[model samples]
Target: MSAGRAGAQIKSFEAWDYVVFAALFVISSGIGVFFAIKERKKVTSREFLVGGKQMNGGPVALSLTASFMSAVTVLGTPAEIYRFGAPFLLFFIPYTFVIIFTSELFLPVFYRSGITSTYEYLQLRFNKVVRFAATIIYIVQTILYTGVVIYAPALALNQVTGFDLWGSVFATGIVCTFYCTLGGLKAVVWTDAFQMVIMMIGFLTVLIQGTARAGGLRNALDQAKNGSRLEIFDFDVDPLRRHTFWTIAVGGTFTWLGIYGVNQSTIQRCISCKTEKHAKIALYLNLVGLWLILACAVFSGLIMYSYFKNCDPWTAGIISAPDQLMPYFVMEIFASMPGLPGLFVACAFSGTLSTVAASINALATVAFEDFVKSFFPNLSDRWSTWISKGLCVLFGILCTSMAVAASFMGSVVQASLSIHGMCGGPVLGLFTLGIVFPFVNWKGALGGLVTGITLSFWVTIGGFVFPAQAAKTHPLVLSTEQCVQLNMTETAPTTAPSVIVNRPALAETWYSLSYLYYSAVGCLGCLLAGLLISFITGPQKGKDVQPQLIRPVGNLFCFWSKKYKRLCWCGVQHDSETILDNLETDTAWKQGTGLDGLKDGQDHLPGYNPDEKSYTNLASEKVTHF
Candidate 1:
């Protein structure tokens, strides 16, 4: 077999490769054109922002999966499993709980609130300051993460395929921005659904082919087992340990809540469904989609280990970073294939497109509704749609530029994830404090948010500057015994590793908290601090707050049980049927559908007017029990 320079086959994109790659952009852009022309002249802000609240469940669910399952998950999870081992798969455990918690607790509150932006709930629950605080956090976190998502895959693909690095970044950013800005949320959703299929097929091609190359599934598992890469459970209680059972189960669930439960992208998509049941169906379908994509990612890691069992790429100096491993493997595995390489890269870009589009769309919605609409309450609805489109264009440019700039940073994979956890925890806490614990006043919510975010940043930044509190868990052994066919030089030293003396325990230091636990620490801290401040500064009675905003977990059990209902919900009692009806009725008016709203003798909210803001609390005083 002819092994080119560096023991890898010569990789280059051919005609078919370009065709396959360009097809993704063309189809995605075509979807945008379809939505843009279909809604021309009649495009209202509601139609633009939330798909007119008439989207079907299946496509929206796929889009939701694509939104959260970024290229980072496609490229990074395998790298995570390859380097750190299989304990990372424990994330699946927490995901199940996330679906249940989000569907039951968070979804009902936001869906019923009849708000375009999720942060608007903060204003209703507490005050404007809290709402804006969470909104700003989300904006910063999502923008930064989108940059990493765009740049990381481009960087890795460039290293392997000689693909233009900056060119890839600009291409993804511009194409995604163009489609989403023109097409609105419907374009993002439909394009995401289309791109999601490509992502699945591309990754599956790699997994199946790499599995066969690693000597079939049985042999792959056998080799992985022999190499110690199959170790899944680690029960260490140390918080600093990166991938322990407790950390993943507890910390992972918290992190996911920060990502999924109250996220604006997820909310906009869910509520866009035609009915409440359709929305629930979307969430549940996304649960399966996440499981499938993530499973493919993790199992591919094992397949990588099996193939490299005798000749590790990193150990042999064939790849510079762990994230490069999968791409390099792709270039090598499909070197002769006409278009599979492009398909895989397209897979990564699909993830990037989904994320960037979601960010652009969600940011526009939040900025327009939370800030612009609030300031210009008298702004016409026609102008609302136009302004939202303009914001989409603005944010799209800003995020794409950020992606290009992110190329200057070094090793952003973990830092971006950490930053997300640091911010998401507090945002999640702000909402949790509102829905689960009604006594937390605005002052307490703001204080808790400040406290939690400050501590999270302190811990995250400290870990970078400080020394290790404990050693990382041992990695499975790697080897380069069969690199003769490849051009490689061994850089790993042959000497025995140095030993450490008097290492402090993981729990001994605050900064030693694992990145996985960042969300948990921040969330728990927010809850504790918010409650203390609420008590000190006069906590409000549950009866005084709106009954619809509070859905205590304590009352979530036994729907027919009256005692738990009365005791737990703070004298606010409503059956599931009554709650869903209220949500449906209010959602109808709030989302610009007049079917059961103004016509059904429900004057609780004003009629939907295209020339006026959808719904507003022009009343300054507390207006309870509408």
Candidate 2:
């Protein structure tokens, strides 16, 4: 190791490092060229946006896993575990339910719709205004998320490899944008399949190697247990308890709904499958991959804690931020190993690239389908594809530009969840209301969305702008007084920690709400507001709303029917003949209330041309599995 600028210990790169990096960029770009040329004759917007709706289980599932496990999960998860302990891993408890709920409840609806964008379902169920609101929310949230994902890995790479932060950001952004813009969904999915393998290899390599360096798995576990880092369950009833069983298992399920249930990045992959059965299979497979990746990330944190149990890096001033810990640990464990450091860098970049590609592609699809295509219904397929690709370039540039701002934020994982909870919660609520409450009119949904988003922003942004005094938790303790290797030859100057002052009581209470509760609050607020407004203005008839837009609970229990009576008693009954209404809704399902039938009452919906070419032709042509 040699001292770099500011006397920081920097790991130098070799010829093999450049070779490894070049291979990643080349393979990814090569896949783009392959797809572009292969699908030249039939390059329609339908094909570019959804992979011709003929995707298989393995590749699409792997792509979903890659997109779900972004650089935020890869980089931020280990840091979270290291700081907070094993309780952070409790998110896995809710994930199982999420897989089932999304596959059974959400996936079938989108698959049956045969629409290009997920927001199309909104237009079909309610009105164009609701759809536009959801679209704008998703576009903004995904763009901001792409920037944060790109920044996390780039910042870590800069610390370990002495690479420029902006240079690394641009490198990953431009490579992913180029491939995603040119190759469309085919290129994005295939490259994601490749990158996910690299990501798995990278994490496994670090876990196995770092475990050995820390004297094996048993010793690592013992060290973590002794340090109070292995405690998994916190049964506290306190809402402020960050990782309690109630918060992690219950509240977390609400948070994940916004990601898997309604987010375009995830739904687009599910809809790409040829049949609903294949889509379900993909969801189950994605769950298994998610579990394995999360386990690996958590174990890596334990290994890190064990290795530095007696030599705290932060206390020694070796790493400036908590997020930099894993990268520095990698350099220490694999400094002499020729290709391992390069592999680690490649792994982080892989995760970043997969997420960026998904954002760019999803944003492009939504922009063209939700905005542009509405204005020009008869726009040729060639021009539709062109507009989609052009939007990809535009969003890709915007994503990179926004990523620079993340350097000023704290805790990448928390920052991402804040954005998701604040923005995504309202969108999920809108979808949920339409699906579960058949009587919720467009006016009701729109009112709920606006109010829910308003509350979320007021609390979240207020906390950021006027933060209260820090709330403390008991982190696992460590000692570094005996550590000799981390000691620098020259002494470094230190600054005193800052003091915090309290704010008004209302602001304090607002800031005291856990980030875990943000989504739940937003979601419940929307549902309540929507229902109230629907009752006040006038609820839609059960016959008016499509059955496909309704969830299984609403379908099976017949909440709108007088026969059920129990569940429907929460509010005044809108329909007197419950049994007949339920029968009619079920009949509507049997008769096929397809996308065209969904827009029965609202005929003036902009940009919705039912006469456009159906995806059945493209699906027939590309129906082969790998």
The best candidate in terms of TM-score: 1
Q: lDDT per residue, candidate 1, 364-448, as tens digits?
A: 8888878997899998877887898898888877877787656544345465657668888888887899988877889999999
Error of 1 at 374 (Å): 2.3
Where model 1 places Cα greater than 4 Å from the true spot, the runs are 1-6, 380-390, 404-413, 467-470, 484-508, 557-564, 573-626
Global fold similarity of model 2 (TM-score): 0.87
User: Candidate 2: global Cα-lDDT?
Assistant: 0.75
RMSD (Å) per prediction: 5.0, 6.6
| lDDT at 134, model 2 | 87
Q: Rate the local accuracy (lDDT) of all candidates.
A: 0.74, 0.75
